[model samples]
Target: MRGSTNRNTRRVRGVLGAAIVVCAVTTALPGAASADPAGVARTAGAEVGTGVGVERVSVAPDGTQSDGGSTGGAITTDGRRIVFSSSATNIAPGNAAGSERVYLRDEPSGQLKSVGSYPIASPVISGDGEYAAYWVLLFRDTKVKLAQWTAGSSIGLNCDALNCSQPSLSGDGRYVANVATIGRPSTSQRIDVWDWHANTKQELAWFDHTAPSRPSISGDGRFVAYQNGRTKDVFLWDRDHGSTSGPIEGAAKEATLVQISEDGSKLVYLSGTDTYVHDVSTGTAHLVPNVKGLAIDPTGNHLLYAPNDTAGPSLKLRDLTAGTDEIVSNQPASAGVDAVSAGGRDVVFQSTADDIVPGDTNGKSDVFVRRFS
Candidate 1:
């Protein structure tokens, strides 16, 4: 079901020019191999999802989906371990104690597991598939949790006395950044970073206004980027320097931050439906122009954007480093992209297009993944 090709070697190099392999350190696969000008290996890559490097992911291994729909796909860099939110009661057996909220799939083994038995959202997984983070609305307040993807044991980083939401994780799952709402007469939002290793939590900053924006933490937990509730602006907090540089967004008209790179060097945000990118090191930001894409590679050097400028109806990987774009998917994704694998090689997204894959006659929103090399 999977195959590889050396098509577009130059464009592929542009996408993988960086030093971040992101996908489980480039495990073995069948295909010819070579080196880029930078000397990075260009292997024809092996089977993913199915044998084709692209396949429907929101279903049973046998492609059963009469149960329910799935959304919010979060993944490890290799696309081997994908965790997502779903309402399907039958994606896997028993659903990890009857949980229809979140599920994890081991693509190589064709195994799946449900997260819990309650309502869950915004599921996120570590780059190495070591942990997963998410929020649950058990009652009036939403609680944030970090769970070991293997053991399923978790610790609640719910801020103790406040309602927390929008949980984001560092690639290693050692750091979790979430928004907590507290205060009396008027509620204010504070972004908190939790260190799973040290078992300590620190408040990055607070806003006078309350909002729904999530905070993104870097892979090492050294940096965090968020949207200020009061001014509709963006801010970056450096834990190493204990400094906060804010309002980094230029002319932001209610800009909302979407994701930050694993290194905190790049950030993606939406300003009234238009996608924008901010280079953290240079303190500069710009609208992507013509298309909207939210997923960023680990190095913050690439993005999975939709409505390819030349391809017409497709998703493209925009190389921030080379200032070029490569259409990754021949079919358009209905809900844009969910995440990009390391080096921007694998792309998973939500699509209602039946033609995206053969036998996708479900005609409903389903998750699909495609690999580009």
Candidate 2:
């Protein structure tokens, strides 16, 4: 999702010396969700995404970090690669001394890497975890930059004539989408899609009279979703067909664009206190029950979310087809859920619950991952 603030399954040595074995037990909570069946299997929780692979994911282990932490949003999919914007210099090597930089944690190797020396924010990493797209502050202006982290290089996606932000990338890292302000006086904002590997960019949508905000892209870059100017309606762009469609019936005017399914048939949005999945072809909407912070899998078979009740929030994995809901986290996540893998097999969230992992005594919000087979 674009508006939220924003982990991995690799076994890396020299990290979290002791690993907690998560169970594959299914716990049933009846009446918790709509169309839910009984006894849905829920995966036990394991702590991951702590940057340093520690029991608790508070600032870096260097003890110089603070509780304020980084921004909340989709930093990555699959929970294998996570990138967060932070000001902590010790979080990664060669971090810009005083600027906020984007950091990536390669869970398989247990390494913390810095993307660049510029100030960055709201980074989104591809499903493969090889690339990251984020907004970087250069000089007095901010532009969207795409980094091929594996290659140790980055290039500005948006030109100097435009100020860009709110970037979204496909699972394979081939397509990068962003919103940028173009033209004089910077009154107009346009949505653009860049073929990272091809080094080509195209404007997907440009409303000379209105500005679109918050873009969500599908795994293969087939579909793109965003708000329709200043209206409550939402729109989806089909890159393959070069066609665009509507306020997507049933979407509340105040709904925030969330995720677009890989096939471009399902659109998810949040309106008021509820989240809805609209079938673009049928123009029908399904309300996800008792959960917020929703992320739908590319297949649309599973949906991941956090308990809507903020006072005692927890992570939930729902099987849309069988109508079953399973609690991913054994304990309440005081800081709420963060991101889910594109396959819905792994979920990353933050919690104040001490029992989520063994020896979690950091006494601060820590990140955890729950995995399912």
Candidate 3:
């Protein structure tokens, strides 16, 4: 069965240029290989749910009727582990209750484990696949709490001020970055980081009106990138330097999503018709025209984005150092590349087009992964 691609929203802008199509990464047949550019050796796209036991799931925020299940802000660097929230019981047992539950799929082992129950959202997983952080509404307390799932147990995070949401974890799973309203009388939302392994907490930034929007921590836990809600500009917090860098000079004031590279060197964001990748060292923005939905690989070298102006739109990848652009997928403009892996090797996205994969009969959007070999 097929699913839908609906999540948080972002603004769209101008048209993209004609894509430079290299040969396909790999042949459609299994075990087939094809020549490709330097950074990406070979590439192939396949359905993520195929042969993985994911069925058509109906999900909504609070028991309303929606088309597909939620990825729950869940993706990993290895492309081998996927965590999502589904309304289907068949994904794993104990989900038979018909409520939304989080499930983790270890692709290499073909093992599916139910992380927990009780209304979860915004799940972020560690690169090593050992830890997960999500928000769960505790009915008894009548407040939202951030829950940490590691090694099959659920641990409640300290959101004592009342509400907590948008949990992001470092690649190593040692540190978690989140937004919570803390202080007596629940003063305001603040961005905080917790070292789960060390059992320590550090406050990165505080906002009086609203939480720093979409706070993202680097894989190494050295930097936190977020949009300063007050200024509507991008800011990067360096743990080692103990300094915050932004309202980034060239960044758009309306920029909503800010993604920091694994090494804490580059920040990518979309502003109007252009996508800008800012160099942390130089504070310079490398502008890519007519692009949206961008992701920077862990190395900070490769960038993947969806062009808004393609005649038949698809995903494209550009090697920053090499200055080479390769068409990631040419499926229609309606199809999008949702997430890219750490090394720019694996990309996961959703498509309503049936031709994205063979035997997609259900006519619902399905998650597909492209692997660069």
Q: Model 3: per-residue lDDT, tens digit, 1-373?
A: 0111112121221111122221111101121112222222233323322322112122222212233443443457766666655565444434456576665655444345566555544456776677665676654232322333334656666643466767777887777777766554555676777775556677766666553567788889988887666556667788877776667743435665657876778888877777888898888889878887567776787788887877854777788888887666677522221255666666555455555443345444444455564
- State candidate 1's TM-score: 0.78
Q: Residue 53, candidate 3: how far off, in angstroms?
A: 19
Cα-based TM-score, every candidate: 0.78, 0.72, 0.73
Cα distance off (Å), candidate 1, residue 78: 3.1
Candidate 2 error regions (>4 Å): 1-78, 94-99, 117-120, 183-185, 208-212, 250-254, 262-265, 280-282, 289-291, 328-338, 351-366
Residue ranges of candidate 3 with Cα displaced over 4 Å: 1-74, 118-122, 140-150, 182-187, 250-254, 332-338, 363-365
Which candidate number has the best TM-score? 1
lDDT string for model 1 (280-357, tens) is 888778668766666888778788777536558567788887888875556656432238777777666776666655
Say what the RMSD of model 1 is.
12.4
lDDT score of model 1?
0.64
lDDT of model 1, residue 121: 62
Instruction: In angstroms, give how far residue 224 of model 3 lies from its true place.
Output: 0.6
Q: Model 2 Cα displacement at 209 (Å)?
A: 7.0
Model 1: pairs clashing at backbone N, Cα or C within 3 Å: 1-51, 1-52, 2-51, 2-52, 99-116
* Each prediction's whole-model lDDT (CA): 0.64, 0.57, 0.57
Sort by lDDT, best first: 1, 2, 3
